[model samples]
Target: MTKVNVYVTLRESVVDPQGIAAKDALHKLGFDEVGNVRIGRLIELELSGTQAEIEERVKKMCEVLLVNKVIEDYSFEIGEVAGK
Candidate 1:
């Protein structure tokens, strides 16, 4: 089995309301050092395939369903499962 870790984040130009709210809450909690806390999504996919095939498929999945290419960016890491 293969383990693919996908990260989806808002573009730099996009406004992240959730992140801003979280930062504000943190500041209220005395975490004044927190700054620009951008929120993102981490999606883990388990599949059976060759590295190249899995990479291609995961990219397609991101483009088609997992990420919003218009206002977001995505990246992924592919690795083999130890005991799968």
Candidate 2:
């Protein structure tokens, strides 16, 4: 089985209100070093396939369902599952 880690994040040009709020709260809590906080999501998927096939499928999945192409950008890493 192959393990895929997908990361989805807002484009740099997009405003992140949740990140802003979290940063402000952190500052109020005295974490003064915090700066330019941005929030994102991670999705882990496990599937059985050759590397090339998995890559193609993952790219299609991202474009068709996983990622928002307009406001967000994504990246993925493929690796072997442990003890598999």
TM-score of each prediction: 0.94, 0.94
Among all windows of 10 consecutive residues in model 1, the one with the lowest summed lDDT is 75-84
Which lDDT tens digits does candidate 2 get at residues 1-84?
889999999999999999999999999999999999999999999988889999999999999999999999999999776457
Model 1 misplaced regions, further than 4 Å: none
lDDT of 2 at 24: 100
- lDDT per residue for candidate 1 within 1-84, as digits (tens), equals 889999999999999999999999999999998888999999998988899999999999998999999999999999767466
Q: For residue 11, what is the lDDT in candidate 2?
A: 98
Taken over the whole model, the C-alpha lDDT of each candidate is 0.93, 0.93
